[model samples]
Target: MKILKINEEISIKRSVDNGTEEQRVVVKSIIERVRQDGDEALKAFTEKFDGISLVNIAVTEEEKREAYKEIDDDLLAIIQEAASNIRSFHEKQLHPSWMTTDENGTILGQKVTPLDSVGLYVPGGTAAYPSSVLMNVLPAKVAGVERIVITSPPDKKTGKLPAAVLVAAQEAGAEEIYKVGGAQAIAALAYGTETIAPVDKITGPGNIFVALAKREVFGDVDIDMIAGPSEIAVLADDTARPDEVAADLLSQAEHDIFACSVLVTPSEALAKAVAAEVEKQLLTLPRQNIASQSIENFGAIYVTDTMEEAIDTINRLAPEHLEIVTDNPMELLGKIRHAGAIFIGRNSPEPVGDYFAGPNHVLPTNGTARFSSPLNVEDFQKKSSIVFYSEKALKENGEKIAAFARLEGLEAHARAIEIRLRK
Candidate 1:
């Protein structure tokens, strides 16, 4: 980790990867093939990309049962408990459809409706992430999405999806699991195939091809976001533990080679201590190669003149994951204006939120935390504005509405109101 003195405004925003022209062209072709060839295209792509021949695109009940058998009883209980916690947390975010009536008999309100269907893409290949399955699927289930589907690549050797991924999806209440991945899976989710029906929205993370495929089918179907690399920033003082801080930073670093882990503090001694600790810990990390490259290229520790300046720098960074590990973390909570998720004190590490802390781990990355948010139940639901004007209310306000419409030079709109008023 490199240590530097903060002299001016700092930004950790990485340039968004929009994919190369060749990748975009390939994604477009894949989507068109799925639309034209349907299930056959899906099978062909699966065989080509995933190295598996699938007699059935969808996972059977027997397969799910076998998956449960593969997972240990203790792990199964843990998954179930995490599911309960996640469900409970998101259930609090639900709001009922509401309306209000005026004395003149006019009614106005917003109707909240869950999406009819949703597709969650779980990344699979070198590794499986059951936590991701829980984070993505449980929110939709909580939001009352009627049909939740999951698509993940199958392991080449076993020709089966990871048992853990399967178990997590089922525990999260998603029964429709498909063994497909990459751009083709995204296409199938966006536009229906013979086996997989189209969804109203798609949510999850994948490789560059998956991201490009999502971008290609965006207007046709809603997507959660174009997520960037993972990021973590720690704002700490002298009281913070150096070893714990270093471990928290490496947790994000091991995710990707581009993942960023930064530390902002006013304590020069703590800064040097954490920098040393990070290097020592990285020597024995399991993903040392990846984490080393990430730390080498994107990791940094900035020494600020004051804690206020440190907070200002963190606000400018607007990191995806932030940890405030000062002596009085709560006192500075209100000063933080931007962060996808804030872990307070040394006890609340970033992975706690990632796995079992009940908050969605799918958060905004790069500088998007400035304006975006973590994946939530609301992302699975849509809003429709309701309007009703009584005869008396229309007569009272129709002329004013017509005038407002005409002010915009929309004659047809004004006539629509005036003709109703004439009646």
Candidate 2:
């Protein structure tokens, strides 16, 4: 891991950022093929890349109904608990459509409308992410998204998605499920197939190709985010435990070699101790090589002048996960301005946000927290501003609107307003 001293504010911005050129090229190619060939291309690519024979491209209703029977009741209980928590958190984000009326007889309001269909891609093959299903779909359910369709590759051995994933999908309320994955899955969702209906929006995480496909199909359909590798930034002080700090950093690193993990602190002693603890913990981890490579390539440690300086550096990194493991974490909450998800204090960690915690785990990566947001119910819904007017309302504002349009040289627009007012 590279150790850089970030005693000044200027050094933080330049020192902690990454560029995303490699992801774009891969995404573009996958998008073009899917757009041209449609279903035939999807079947061919699934066989070539995933090595699964094409018996069927869609999972049946029987499979979804049997999903609950396959799940262990105890585990099903936990899934229910998690789903309830996620629903509770997202329910608070819901907005009701409304209108207002004035004595002037003008009616105006905004309407909240769910997208006609949303395509959710769950990462499949050897990796099963049940938590992702709950995170992605619960918000959409709460928001009353009209249709939520899911796609995942079946296990070659079992010809089914993981039981946990299936249960989560059923519990969180997916309207349809398909047996497909990767860039082809994204393409099917974006462009539509004989089996899969094209969605208005697509949201989920996948490999570089999948991320790229989401980016590639962006104009055709809206995507949640062009996510990069996962990232975590932990801010520690003397009060923070070295083992906890080291463990938290390694948690994100274990995701992949390109994943990022970092620790920033005002305490030089804590930095040295955490560095040693990381080495000790890494040897015992099952994913040692993955974690170690990630630490070697993208991991970092920065010693800052004060806790405030550390917060400034964390803001500069704008990581996917931020943990404020400091003396008074709540004190720093007001200080933090950017991050996909902020897990406050020593007890809170990224995994909490990943699974049991109610917050959506699909977060902005690659310093995108500076502008983007975590996936939520808001992502599944669309808003349209409604304007109504009686003749009185139109006449009251008509002259001012027409004058502004005339000044901008939009004569036709001005005439539209002027004609209304004159009548």
Candidate maximizing lDDT: 1
Instruction: List, residue by residue over 379-398, the lDDT tens digit for candidate 1.
Output: 99999999999999999999
Clashing pairs in 2: none
Show where candidate 1 strays beyond 4 Å. Answer: 7-9
Error of 2 at 238 (Å): 0.3
What lDDT is reached at residue 133 by model 2? 94
**Please, what is the TM-score per model?**
0.98, 0.93
Cα RMSD to native, each candidate?
1.2, 2.7
List model 2 lDDT by residue over 1-423, tens digit each. Answer: 666797444221222222257656655666668778777777777788777777677777777778889889999999999999999999998888999998888998989998888989898887689998999899988888878999988786776788788889988988588878887889889888787779999998887677767777888899998777788899889999999999999999999888888899999999999999999999999999999999998888898888888888988888889999988899888988888899988778889889998988999888778998888878988999998888998888888888899999999999998887776
Best by TM-score: 1
Worst 10 residues of 2 by lDDT: 10-19
Off by over 4 Å in 2: 7-37
